[model samples]
Target: MGIDPKTIDWDSLGFNLIETRSMYKATCKKDDSWSPGELIPFGNIELSPAAGVLNYGQGVFEGMKAYRTLKNRIVLFRPEMNAKRISMSTKRLCIPEMDEELFLKAAIEIVKDNVDYIPPYGKGSLYLRPVVWGTGPVLGVKPADEYTFIIFASPVGPYFKGNIKPLHLKVTHNFHRAAPKGIGNAKAIGNYSASLYPSSLAKKTGFDEVIYLNAGNEQLIEEVGSANMFIVKDNVLKTPRLAGSILPGVTRDSVLTLAKEKLDIEVQETDVLLDEVCSADEVFCTGTAVVVTPVGKITSEDGEHSINDGKIGIITHELRSLLLGIQREECEDTLNWLHPID
Candidate 1:
C-alpha cells in the first residue's frame, strides 16, 4: 500500500512499521568485496532456509531517525556515529564492513526517497532501520560466504506514547541481556533474543521494562530492556560504565555530553549498584526510540521505591526538552549533531 502522509493521522501513530516507498540494498561476495548498493522497491527477497543468519544468527542492525524541522528541513541525528557503530558490529559478526561514506550515502538516499512519508515537525519522525546479515547457506557453523545489507524506514510516533509520564521498571535477576566480554557492546540480533522473556515477564508483572544486571554478580546495574539507565544523587548524573557488556548507545552518549556541557551537571560513568538506584533522587533511561524517559518507580524483590517522589525530576525534564528542542531545530545546534537530508 502506498503511504499518503496527508490521509494518515500522525498524532495517533505508534512505534510500528508501515513500509515506505523503497529501501537501499547491497551485497557482498565470497571474496569479501562489497558491491555498490542501490535503492530498490521495498519487498522480501528469497533466502535459503540454511542461511547463516537463520542458522547461526550472524547479523547486526542499527536504529536511527530523520526528523522534520520547524523550518521544513529533514535532518538526521548523528548518522556518522551510527555508521561507525554498525561498521564495528559488522566486523564483530564476521560480515564485511561497509564504508562509513557508503553507509551514510545509502541512509541519505533512503530518507530522501521517502521524504514525503516524514511526518510534519511536531507530529512524529521517520525511523530508519539498517540491517546486515549473513545470507550464504552453510551447514557448518561459520561466517557466511555471502552477506546482504539493507535499510528500510517507517514513520513512528514517540516510543512511549501519550503524555510523557514517568515509567516503572523491575530489576530482573533471573535473566541477563549479555554476558561478560560477550557481543553485548555490538548491536547484534542475538542480544535482543535473550531479553525477550525477561522483558515480557516484567510487563506481565505490570512493569514498563526490565532492568538487567551484570551476569556474574547480578549486583551492578547494566541497562534496561531497550535503553540505557541513569541515576541522579547529590546533584550528579551517573550511568553504568561501558564494560563490554553494555551497548554504548548514541543517545546515552548525547545525554552525558549534554548534561556536562549544556547543563553544567557532573556526569559519571561508573558501576551503578542496584541499591544506589533504589535510593537515587532521580532515574531515567535513554535510547534512539524512547529518547529520554524518567523512571518514577523501581520494583524489585524488596518492594517498590519511588524516585524523586514518583515525579519527573527537574534535570530529567530539562534534558529531555533540550534534546527534543535540538532535534526539532527549536534550539541551537551547537553540537553539530544534525545532518540535513537535503
Candidate 2:
C-alpha cells in the first residue's frame, strides 16, 4: 500500500479529500464494548438505509493533524484534547464513548500506514479525521444498538487560499448557526448542515465566510462558519465565551494559552457585541483546519468596517507564527503539546 509522492501535486493540495493507503475502523457492539481497531484499505463503507446516523443524525467527529517534523519525525498536536471532545460529543449524541487509548492508537496507526501521504515538511501536513456514527438500523427515535468509529487521513494545504493575508467576513443577523442551549457545543454533523445555506449566501456575495450571532439575542457574536472568532482591542485579547452555543475549539484554546504564557497578553472570554467588534483593533478566527486567520473587514447591514486598516495585525501575525512554529517543531514546545507518533 505504499504511495508514490510523485503522483501527488503537494504544492497545489487544497482542503479536499485525497484518500490515503489505509484507515482505522472499530465497531461498538450491542453490549457497549468496542472491538479492537485495525487498519483497512481506504474505501467506501457499507451502511443500512435506516441507520441511526442517516435518519436521526447520531454522529460525532474530531479533526486533527499529523505533522512531519524538521527531524523527520511524525507527531500529533494535543490529540488528547480531541479525544476528550469526541467523548463529550458522543455522550451528548447518545453514542457509545470511544476509549481514549484506543482512539490515540487508531490515530497513530492510521498515520503510520499512510505515512507516505504525509505532505513534505513545509508544503502542508496530514489531516486526520476521526468519526463515530451509529450504524445500526433503527426505525424509532432512539439511539442505535451498534456504532462504528473510523479514522482516516488526507493531505491538505491551507484551508483558505492565497498567502497569509487578511480575510473579509460577513456578519449575518438573518441566520443563526446554533441555539443558546443546544448541541452547538458538540462537534455534531448537523450543525454544519444548518450553516450551509447562510455560508453559501455569504460566499456568493463575495465574502470569505459568515459570522453567526446567538440565536437568542442575535446581537452577541457566536462564531464564524467553521471557526471561533476573537477580537483584539486595547491590548487585550477577547473571544466569545463558550456558553453552550459555540464549539470550544482546540486552536482557540491554544491561542489563548499562548497569548497568556508566551506573549504575556491579557486574555478575556465574554460576550462580544457586534457594535464593539466593528470597532475592534483586530479580528481573527481559529479552528483545526484554518488554525488562525486574520479578519480584514466585516460587512454588516450598517456598513463594512475595516479591521487594523484592512491588514493583518501584529498580534494575529505573531500568534499564528508561534502556533505554526510549535506545530512544525521549528520552535520549542514548552507546553509539551506535541505527541510523537512512535
lDDT of 1 by residue, 70-138 (tens): 878999999999999998899888899767888999999999998988988888899999999999999
Q: Pick the candidate with the highest lDDT.
A: 1
Model 2 TM-score, 2 decimals: 0.97
All candidates: TM-score: 0.97, 0.97
Q: Write the per-residue lDDT of candidate 2 for residues 1-342, one digit (tens) a residue.
A: 435656999889988888788888999965586667788888889999999999999999999999898877899999999988998898889888777878888888988888889988877889999999999999999999999999988999866656877889999878999998899999999998999999999999999999898888877999989899999999899999999989989999999999999999999999899998899999999998888999999999899999999998999999999998999899999999999987
* Alpha carbon lDDT at 2, candidate 1: 45
Pairs of colliding residues, candidate 2? none
Could you give the C-alpha RMSD of every candidate to the true structure, in order shown?
1.2, 1.4
